[model samples]
Target: MTRVRRGVVAVVVLLSVVLAATPSTVAASSVTDQLIRRLNRQLLYMAVPIAVLVEIILIYTLWRFRGNDEPRPTRENRQLEITWTVATALVLLFVGTASFHALAHPSVSTIDGESSDVPDDAVEVDVTAEQWEYAFEYPDAGVATNETLVLPENRSIYLSITAEDVVHSVHVPELGLKQDAIPGETNLLRTELTGTGEYRLYCAELCGVGHSGMLSTVEVVSEDEYEAWLEDQRAGEADNESATDATNESSGGDEP
Candidate 1:
């Protein structure tokens, strides 16, 4: 092969090697994540070969027609045009179908008036976003936390997200969960935890000056551990309320 051909071969080989070695590093911790990862890999596999073929064809055409000769008008081939058009349409159809399959997954998106596929026992949590912080409240457990979101492993989770101030987004990349938190409007996100671990959470939208610092943690633990944590939070809240009442009574007694 000539020098240019050899260089092209080397580049293609290197790209193939890199693509083969690069594994999906983002761990899928939930059903939503798994679906998203699978769709991404499907698209990548389809796109890479097409891209490589197009590049190879372009390179070959440039090299083969490099001579300074009179250019001949290209004749249109109806058969070739029809074949390519049909092939392109099929590829697009496949892409759209695959995308819809993943995007419409109940765990990935919840549309209005459509009943979600989340399990009946799914743990529901209310997520409230402010200027620079996220607060999580477990209505059933009657516990709330701002520092960390505690969830039970191997269980479905439903998050009702809303903003108290400007627009914000709740994004937990590990679980492939992201939803906008808009003031006066609530958005729902569903996912099932598949493992126990700590995942980073962030506000994906620019809300205010402290937007960059809007961060938190999602800690998925065993069911027993989650129950214990909720109990602890409840006890702490009770103690704080008792102290406030005692202070109020003392102040009232000492009034002139």
Candidate 2:
């Protein structure tokens, strides 16, 4: 029992240390990322000590009371039992309060509220997901793309996410942003990009066989460069529309 307990303690300690050393890197692109990272660290701090203490107590009890002799019933120490129970309850209360405070925080939970944490000049992008692909549309910019998502860095973005087929999840790990895209329901998420870099966007949910292929890039560019890209997309779309219109008119004349 002592050996088993020691083994458990060693494994637990090693895991705890490793996790603490390599905590998830929060990009801190927005307030939500900061809140999430803060909460994670706080929980880790609380959990490690409690876990070690509990393991120690369990091992000591097993070693001290080990035997196959005639089972002798011992009277319960009510005060000791009460003390430990109360201690456990207090720990739970403290952790619960902390979790609730973080979850109820305004910056983390008010994604769709009327209150304006988002800037007035924030850009809006409509995100649509299907079984195996993502389509991004910038209505204001008159540009849409299926292969890549381009946005201006250091600016707030309001994302309107929806699914064309089954439910999907949109996740941008660098920004620590994720939102569910459900059919017939539009979910909104707001965040700001803190730097200009390429980030990977993934479908966090398993939609189908091609879910592994449901990958794309998020390119955060300067405002001027973003505008230029949008202009080029708009021009290409105009040319395609004109060519389609001409083709239809020529086909109609030939049929007559």
Candidate 3:
């Protein structure tokens, strides 16, 4: 019995140490990851102790209390059983309580109420999805093109997304934002970047044959760079508008 208890302790300790070294990388992408880790720890804390206790009891009953030549009357320890059962229930209760706390948490939702999570100083971007292509439209910056989105750090962003013909979902794993773009209904996503870097975005649903091509990049840039780029796009847009107006005037004058 003693040897068995020692072995169980050693195994549990080794398992815990090994597990402490690795946390799921895919899970860390969301804010809820912290909740998941905490819940896991709580459950482990309860399970490890109970499992060791059970192993000790079983080994002790088998080796120390067994009679080789005499028959023994069976006796029940109701109090002991109830005590361990209640303790286990209490531990599970703690885990359940923690999970409830996470579920009750209010994540960044643009569904209703005051959606001021996206800072007022944010640069608005409209993302339109069609077939298998992605088009990013920065109205405030006078930029509309089928390319990656560059954002400024420490700024909140509001994405008003929609689809032209079918339904699609825009998913950014790093930002933990995914929203559906229905053909008739528009969806909004609000997010902020704390660190400056690049991230990948993908379409969550399989829409059509080229659904795999529904991918994009998000580049986080400095505030100064974002403002300068916005200026360049505005200048270029003005030039295009002037050429279009000149062509329209020439065509109208020659029509009749």
Candidate 4:
């Protein structure tokens, strides 16, 4: 077989092996995740074919004129050049369009300035990151927790993320969400929960010695359950405040 024929055969065999190893489908839990996965697959498909074609052309050119003592100057083909130029432009346009579609999504991008675009009914939570831990506060509910981030399923969420110390990042792979927490600056991350489940949260940036231990859980619960939990927390906070006030009064009376 000629060298060009061997190269063609090799390319075919390699493609077959890769196709067989690739999974038919990958499951995604959220719409944003699905969009990202689709974009990745599209890029992969385009890249593989382009790489293979380039390699085949390189191999053929190398082997076809191996023993030529005097090589003639190559003639330019305007038609081929124009065809490839147009093709390249179209490919770049497609990539830019697809990327913009994904990036414009509220769940994928951060909000700037006033959050007028944010839904009025969206749950608002302030996320504070320190050296070794994260704190979640629900301003509307007047509840705060450092253990877990509790969110309501099937509802839009707006998280105002900031850092108390060094820079940190909140990453939730399952939700396809990541936002940086910078000191004195708050970034808004918006997303809608689709189901009730526990997702792992991690600090993607290395902040300090305990960076590895900065882990938490995001718990998505039903609307009713979330309301009940918030009520319980409020009541507990009220009782604590009352007890502290009574103790202070008793100490003052004894002092006089």
Candidate 5:
């Protein structure tokens, strides 16, 4: 019985080691993902030891009092039962406290602190989604870009998102972010790109026939490069509205 319990514990430890060593780290980060992962990882971490202890106790009890040789006692160990019940409650309480802490992190309220919880001094970008395009509005910069979104690294940027037509979700996998854009209401999210690189921005929700082409690029650049990109975007007619108008004008389609 002792050997079996030891083997099970060994396996658990081995698996935990492998999981911790895996090279799945390093990527873009968002507030929602950060909080959820932290809370869930902590919960599982707390559970494993308790589970192993319970298994060992159960195995010993089963082996010691088997069959008629040790006729099952009718009396219950009320004290032991009460102790276990209190332990279970304590575990649950800890889980709740940790989870609440994760949720309460100011970052969870919005991306990069555009929400009421975070200071309003951060950069704000208005992202509007249509059938197959992601049009971003940098109100402070007076620039809108459809091809690529240029963001500054290390600083939190808040995104206020809405749909121009149907429902859509903006997702930047490397940034550890995703949020829905509804037609009537604005949804917000915060993220900080840790490094300088070009990442893919995708529409996670379906909209229409051209939804597959609803792809955009996320470019993380230094302060100077970001400012230059903003200026260039402001001077170009790369917004979704301009593209749609040009298409309709060429085809002589219905007026807007």
Candidate 6:
């Protein structure tokens, strides 16, 4: 029994040390991700010891009271009962209070509408989700693209998401942002990209048969590159508008 207990303790201690020394020590991109990492680390730190303790107690009890020739009535101690009840309540309260910061983080709220909960300097982008694809539209830049979300690094991106057909959820794990896109209702999520790289965007909820294929890319670029891309898009939009106007005039003259 002593050997078994020692082994369990050694294993638990090693695991606890490994968990504490790694993973969460790395830097996260956004505040939301950092908070989530903190919450996870705290939870694991609390849970591992409690789980090992419970297992040890179970093994000890089974070994100590294995053979019973005559079954005896179990006596309930009022003091013990009260002590454990209070202890459990205190533990729960402590955990809940500790988790409040992560649970009630402001970034998770979808307050008023599109512009709500967004910073003044944040760029707004419209996200439209359909069958198994996503369409990203930049009204300010006059650019609309399918399957790619372009943004400037180190800037807050305010995504106003809505579903054109069925319900879908936007999940960008690197940014720790996820929001449901419902038809006829716009949902907003804001997050800042710290590094310039391509992040994967996935539909977290099952929308249809092609739910697995509902994937996209979020490309974070430099401010200069973003500005140049916007300018090119605007120029293309102007040219298309001119062509449409000329076609409309020619068709009108033919009708007359």
Report per-prediction Cα RMSD to one decimal. 2.7, 4.6, 5.3, 3.1, 6.1, 3.9
- In terms of TM-score, which candidate is strongest? 1
Q: Each model's number of backbone clashes?
A: 0, 0, 0, 0, 6, 0
Candidate 3 C-alpha lDDT tens digits along 50-144: 66667667856766655657867778999989998998788778878976775554434545222455655977888889988888898766688
Mark the 10 consecutive residues where model 3 has the least summed lDDT.
106-115
lDDT of each: 0.86, 0.80, 0.73, 0.85, 0.75, 0.80
How does model 1 score by TM-score? 0.88
**RMSD, candidate 1, Å:** 2.7
Q: What TM-scores do the predictions have? A: 0.88, 0.72, 0.66, 0.83, 0.73, 0.78
- Whichever of 1 and 5 has more lDDT, that candidate is 1
Residue-wise C-alpha lDDT for candidate 1, range 1-256, written one tens digit per residue: 5867777785877588558845577678888989999898878777777777787787667767878498898898999999999989988998999999998888887643223565677798999999899999888788888989999988878888889989999999888888899898888888888988999999999888999999999999999999899889999999999999999999999999
Assess the local accuracy of residue 106 in candidate 4 as a C-alpha lDDT between 0 and 100. 74
Model 6: how large is the Cα RMSD against the reference? 3.9
Q: Candidate 4 — what's its lDDT?
A: 0.85
Rank order (by TM-score, best first): 1, 4, 6, 5, 2, 3
The C-alpha stretches of model 1 lying farther than 4 A from their native spots are 1-26, 112-118
Error of 2 at 131 (Å): 3.8
lDDT, residue 105, candidate 3 = 49
- Predicted candidate 2 versus true structure: per-residue lDDT over 1-256, tens digit per residue: 9678777876787677657655566466655667778788788777777776776677667666777466678889999999999998988998898888877865455343233454678888889999899999987778888988998977777888889999898888767778888898887787677678888999999999999999989898999998899889999999999999999999999994
Q: How far off is residue 117 in model 6, in Å?
A: 5.6
Clashing residue pairs in candidate 5 are 28-174, 28-175, 29-175, 111-189, 111-190, 112-190
**True lDDT of residue 122, candidate 3:** 73
